[model samples]
Target chain A: MKFQQSQEMRNLIAAIFVGIFSYFIIKALTDFDIVPGVSYIYNLRGPLIAPNMITVILFDWRGYDTLGEAFILITAVLTTGILFGRGVLGGDVSEKDSTPIRPSTIVQKVFAAPLVFIIVAFGVVITLGGHITPGGGFQGGSVIATAFFLSVVVYGFKKNVFNLSHNSLETLEGVGALIYLCLGLVGLGLSGYYLYNVGADLYPYLGVGDTATRLFSYPDSTNAGIIPYLNIGIALKVLSGFCTIITVLWGAEKK
Target chain B: MNGSEVQFWSFVTAALLMIIGIYAIIFMDNIIKKIIGVMLIGDGVNLVLITEGFKPGGIVPIISEKLYNQSPGIFQEFADQASYSLPFALVLTNIVIGASTLAVLLGITIKLYQHYNSLSVHEIFKEEKI
Candidate 1:
């Protein structure tokens, strides 16, 4: 009756408003050229000495923003832990009334091993090759987290093959953040700028030659410096942070 | 259609997605549905930001030896043709922030459900009053 009519009226009004709004938005977007005439990426890329412009921008040009983003994730994770109570922080020690679900088939079980291996290997490649390729720490970290998530889903949380405890995950996350902070401090000590890539001088030889060559090489100002280390730190932090969130949420029992 | 025209259509689609997400947030009764709408809005905004950096004729922002070996003057040409990289960087940051926020919100929603025994906002509010 009245409720149904009011809902219909609301829908109509919403439709009209959206239509008008979208039209104006599209018109403005079409008319304006937001793309720059010349991107500063090329000029910055040579000095930063990173093959990937996006990485240089993310880990070098705007490193502080990323540091803040990591803290945001940490705060959110902490909030979730607090809201869920002690079970998550302490691990799933409580007695479960219902049995955990496991993959029931032999075929599913046999293939799971290879799949996990491949996924983890691929994540490593992406994270390590981030400077030379499109993939970066964030993408690689998510992929790694997905691998853990898949294992938990198929094998059940109780019998997860990774055997990652809550404390271990927390420690890994903290260590990652500390490493990032230390790298930034090192840069500040050397170059008088926070998060500067002073270690980038070692990059060119590492890029061109073998591992043996890199060990014998000296640092040059023309290399990518601390960017790779930053990427690794970010990857570790992101992967562990995500894994912690999932593990906490999954372990919490519904009352 | 021309390149700019195609970009314009993309913009239109992104705007529509954002509008639909807003609509869901405003009208949906389910708490989970509102969260889905929030995620949709985030995706729409990310798309808009990424697309805003599109050049009419641009290559990927990566620099190769081939491009560098061409000539010293070629770098300037390459820079002119490359798509803006800043927006891509910004979007990456936005995505991580969005994921964490969504996780927090979902955790809160689960807590609320545990207490109220209902996912409906109206139902929860009614229960609170009594």
Candidate 2:
């Protein structure tokens, strides 16, 4: 009875149960024959919208789903802001100053500034080139956010290259979300649907041809339509959302 | 080497990940460890999804300009060789959601630590009048 009541014994029993459950799951999944249809169709038709299949799928085919996912991120950021926003929304009289803090050594400071620029540049490239490349908004946004974290955590939010404030970050997030919403609204206006690929001129309902295409499409080899613009919106939103969360969590004291 | 072999191994890896995650969630006393376990579970499910999209010998789902310029028959061949991309899109969205959620959870954890001055789950849950 004593042994059964112990944490170790509880762990063992839990492990055994999970193992048995997964064993059956694995067997069923392994034996099942998956006949895929939508993916095959998407592979054939995906390039008509964009050369990159995954990007097209995320931004064009299932843009609604992605919108919901983005809302989840935005909501989470707001939740964190609420959790740590003691002086932010309503609290004490606040005056904020950027702190001047040096790294332990001269060599570290010299490298940090230039490296941050390089990282931000790389993230921009990934974000912009997402349509014709492997990356998308999410990956590129996180890459940029990583740079923000490095600089803010190491050099304190007072880096010589850039200064970030909560208000500015919130504005960026709002603009990002507005971009996405407006793009969808344009689709609704043109083709009577949300997030229709107007650049493709693929939809039968979108009777407006060359003129519409010229107005909306990204200046690239293929007509990725609103996808690239959507990528930019998502990247900006994600970058700011993450930055906001970190700033709140860091609980920067006003000097 | 082949489709089934790769699929089976991937499933096994996913199963192992989930089992470890479950154990960590149940056995570990630290809130951070439990959060880590939740992440592991998410990763395991993502692996299973991506593995489902794999083929025996498949290329990336991207179509290059050169391939597009090729004859219609060649383009069709590219389609046949390419892996399913829907799961990849799902995984990408999930990754972003997971990261943001992790940040939120950790922020909450920090506040809890400040209040309780303890990271132990047992201590956090101990009966206290207040």
Per-prediction TM-score of chain B? 0.90, 0.89
Q: What is candidate 1's lDDT per residue for A1-255, written digit by digit as tens?
A: 012543677667777877787678767766766846324644334433666778777887788998988888888877777776644655634434233575458876777767988998899889877776788788888899998888888887767767888788888898888988998887676556677556554334323224423432224322566676777888899889999899878866677
Q: Interface Cα RMSD per model, in Å? A: 3.7, 4.5
Q: Give the per-residue Cα lDDT of candidate 1 at A152.
A: 83
Model 1 DockQ (Cα-based) = 0.52
Question: Looking at model 2 chain A, which ten-residue stretch has the lowest summed lDDT?
Answer: A1-10
lDDT of 2 by residue, A1-255 (tens): 012243446666766887888788777666756665698888888877888899989998899888888888888888887666534555743424334454546776677778888999999989998989998887788789888887775677755345878889988998998899888988888778888877777665658567767887788888888888899999999999988887776663422
Per-residue lDDT value at A202 in model 1: 30
- State in Å the error of residue A219, model 2: 1.7
Per-prediction TM-score to the true structure, in the order listed:
0.85, 0.89
| RMSD of candidates 1 onward, in order | 5.1, 3.5
Give the lDDT of residue B99 in candidate 1: 92
Q: Write the per-residue lDDT of candidate 2 for residues B1-130, one digit (tens) a residue.
A: 6778988888888877876777678778899998998899889888888887887788899997777888442357668889988888898878877877798889878878877888888778776522
List candidate 2 stretches off by more than 4 Å.
A1-16, A86-102, A252-255, B72-74, B128-130
